[model samples]
Target: MRSFTGWTCLSNPSTNHLASLASAWLLWAMMATSLLAQPPLHVDGRRGPYHDHGRHGGPSGEFDLVEPTGAVTGRISLRRDQLIYRHGDGRQVVYRRNGRYDTPDGQFLGYYNTLLARVLKFPRSGFGHFLYADLDDFTPFPQASYRLLHPVGAGPIGGPIVGPWAGGYMTHDISVYGGGLGLPWLAPAPAFGWGMNAGPLGPMPFAPFPLNPLPLSPIPLNPGPVPIDTRRVALPDLPPAKIRFTNSSQRDVNVTLSDARQAGLSKTFRLGPAETHDMKLRRDAGHEWVETYELLSPDGQWITREVRHSIQPQPRYEIVVHEWRVQSVAIDRTARGNNRIEDINMQGKGIGRFLLPPGPELTDQTIDVFQSARAMQNQGTVTPLISDEQIQEQFRPSDRVSPFERALLQQQRAIQQAQQGQR
Candidate 1:
């Protein structure tokens, strides 16, 4: 016998390439012969080849021999029960069940479901039955494109491989069902079928191979425009009007008036943490006048105490004139430190006072008037004014009056005129 290795070595390079091509052709021919030699995998429940078809098999003895007029092609190793089809592209046309074939390279394409059924026709060149028979809209079979053999079966002849696409598989163990397929696999009977049919694998039915798998043809992502931020800042209400007061020591302090009107005034005075101070507010004008007393620190850093009062008219019919007087003002410093008033006391006449009903009951008219006046006072809280004394104290004989001061004085005169006209 000739040595096979020596024969291979002695072959010419061109001859070797031709011989290899010839051998490949021979192998393909043999494969085709083998496929043709085997009887069609019986659909009538037979266990082997050469079995008789059931009476239901159409035209039992008449075998249809489809001739290939073009290139033969097909996917290998698909599921055993899927429906299959062949589609033609371009100028090519598949061999219909009617037994006609046409092609131009892009003509015939094979498609299969899970039951190994031939639902679609291909060119006679395309052989091999699809492994699958059912093509449900849902329930995608990842490996349905081709049949792959299971290694443990009876060599290569037993059957095509039937495993999950990645590494996933159907199982019976409860733990496996819970840990692997999630809760759906553990569900009972018909429910499991429903769940499986309703899952992600159910909806998609398309060609298994991606048309373009390279990263260069990536899916596009779109990001829309960003939103704008709109916000606002708010300010607190204006501070209350300042009231000047003089105590028995002749020291002056400025008090913040909380509410001041003809009826009464309410003020908040902060002594030290634990100190107390006496506050007096008397009217030197009409009976409806009221005042609030506020004490200030020497450095004007703090407000010591706040006092509020309603000045009632003395019962005298004879030109009842009232005067706002500071009987005596004292600071209670026992709680923390010595208390002192920093500013000069303000003494003014014509502060209005009102007569109260003999009984504690308040009249509606009195309440309405008082409320209106209180509203006016609140409005004046933010208005700036200079006292005559302050003007005199700050004025120098050689200095001329400022335009702003002159304007302010004119405004003051106009206000006085308006008040006199209203009276």
Candidate 2:
């Protein structure tokens, strides 16, 4: 034994070192094994995919901004109908609500008014304080002078509503901004009834963490022979229907066929690879039929929730045809000039939304993870609803905070808190 600054040392230091190494190796192996045990991960990127990497420009250049004219450095919070601009790199000058401000970039902006202050703000003939600015990018996103229209509102969000307007463009600035939103803003603030309860679109977890989306639980699965959760079917009341989906794409595709929600049991049969999924759907009458192809993103998130109107009986076989909902910014106008900056009032604005179709379906393995989620008529395990806290704990959030994001989050929180107090 050797006496060190501490005390006595191992007689054979090599043995001690070997033991330590063994422990570390064991821990690492366990960690890796656990990671591998996670459900076969996938993401769907087919829906109106936005590559916004400076694509689509005149001849060759970074993608042009939709606004043909505007302060080059300023940003319009379209989701919130707010505009902040500056000519050079000086401090930003925010255009006020129900106000119109001209940008050196040749753009005109109008912020909407709620307190009847609109009539005093813009050209009396039309555009009564509804974002009637005229940057005139020639895009058809409802850009008439009358309160400047925007093809807003997602497809009937709560239920079913297909919007006619194409969505806004994908920009690098917003990407960075949205990333900042992921920062943690726990302190309560005053609420000013901002369109987006979470403030401007920040990257996630940072700003727009307003239960914006419930943290999804990853499916617990081993990457081997896919397990079929034979228990659940589309409709339990109706007779069992047979269904099959073949993965015809060169790349592996995940197909999920869920029956119309009714009765006690809603069946969901999951399949993958090139295999044809043989599943069941309720075979009664009424609104019956599986919604076609909910293409998952590469990361296995549910993309579209389109309701299938066509009802039918099985055995049904569907060929998984790889399709894409090309997404690009376009101009939408009208002779009557209506639905301008419109649907936001209906769809709960401020989340920075563009027409988003559910991307392709990569995988629905989470269906297996929902082993606990199966609580229809108590046929399966009755587990408590997963809490957001539990999810955050498991998936530790990052600490990426930008200076601008931090300030914005604080301001939004203050506004939110104030609003709450008034209520």
Candidate 3:
């Protein structure tokens, strides 16, 4: 090749030199234009955040597939049980959850490695599989482009490799269910990572810890037995006792006070609800006293009778009469501090299917209010039952019917006639 200096020194030196300088300038301009026309370089190695489908920069959580060329070419939408991969160019592919994928070329097996954030695809022809890394969206390579596997399963083709992108399956703050290629991994993920399906291996069931299994025995926290008291003491002979009586019942009551010392001698005092009465008795017959008290309703009906023979001087007693009383007892058999696994059988079809519906056989026969009241007044423990005539009278419909109800009846009659004609 002749140099620029050589060209300048040729015959007609000035003209030749000018021609060589013009050629050099033209060549430099062409080279600059070509360089400018090329795509921008991604020097940071990190995939830009804008490529995300409104979240992480990956298809694990989204249906849209952002290409390495920053163009959203297609999407992976779910249709029933399979995932449909739709391309912008109108081509389609289907992927099953069992690690089997079908392409335009043929059927292939694919698995994602969450640890490396890459997809390993095995074609139908060979045992080797191609690996497609998670390159930046601005990268020059096309999205579907993948590297050919090494012949002997050597180097980065088959061996496990770790880098800045390793274990960083989620490029952004969002959590992704799967890794690259939007597929499940072949193995379980490590701790503090999102779990993915095991492809043909199915799901990984939870295995109980062998050592230090949870205890299932009941806690030793039962209470002790009740105690019995047995003792006796001599009574002291004393007098001048005081007694207070209260009427806690809803109705008014009359209290009758009598002393054995004086026969046919008694005093009656009326006590209203929540009313209290006090009584003082002197030393009668030298500390040998006998007191009898009786409580009666307003109509002279006996309510309660009590007799007291005390040898104390100033013995104080308080009586309260409540109209109503309630008694209840509860037993708890729940086992506390027990963590045993228990399976509960759920009734999906409902127990109502096996149960008898609400009818007269399943419910108590209703009684008439007037007859029941009469029976309670005449026979204390007897309940009144409704007669057959009363039930038939209550079920009888009225002669009058509204316009809307008459229309419904006419429609029903028409339907019945049509059924009869067809028969």
Q: TM-score: which is higher, 2 or 3?
A: 2
The candidate with the higher TM-score, 1 or 2, is 2
Q: Higher-lDDT candidate among 1 and 3?
A: 3
For candidate 2, write residues 249-360 as lDDT tens digits: 2222222232333334333332233445554333433333433323223233435433334333333212112111111112224533221211110010011111101112
Off by over 4 Å in 1: 1-248, 251-254, 257-423
User: Clashes in candidate 3: how many?
Assistant: 1
- Once fitted onto the true fold, the runs of candidate 3 whose alpha carbons sit more than 4 angstroms away are 1-16, 33-53, 59-91, 94-423
Cα lDDT for residue 423, candidate 2: 60
Q: Write the per-residue lDDT of candidate 1 for residues 1-423, one digit (tens) a residue.
A: 111000000111223444545544543443332222211222244322111323321111111221132132422222222212222232322212211211123222233323333334222112222122234535322122232211111111221212111111112111111111121111111110011122222212221122211111111111111112212222232222222222221122222333233435345332221223443233223222222222222121223332223443332111111122232223333423233321222232222233323211221221222222233434322322223555334333122333553454456556545655665
Query: With candidate 2 superimposed using the best TM-score fit, by how many Å does residue 84's alpha carbon deviate from the native?
Result: 20
| Candidate-wise lDDT, in order | 0.24, 0.25, 0.29
Score every model by TM-score. Answer: 0.13, 0.15, 0.14
* Model 2 regions more than 4 Å off: 1-106, 116-361, 364-366, 369-423
Superposed Cα deviation of residue 418, candidate 2 (Å):
77
Error of 3 at 289 (Å): 99
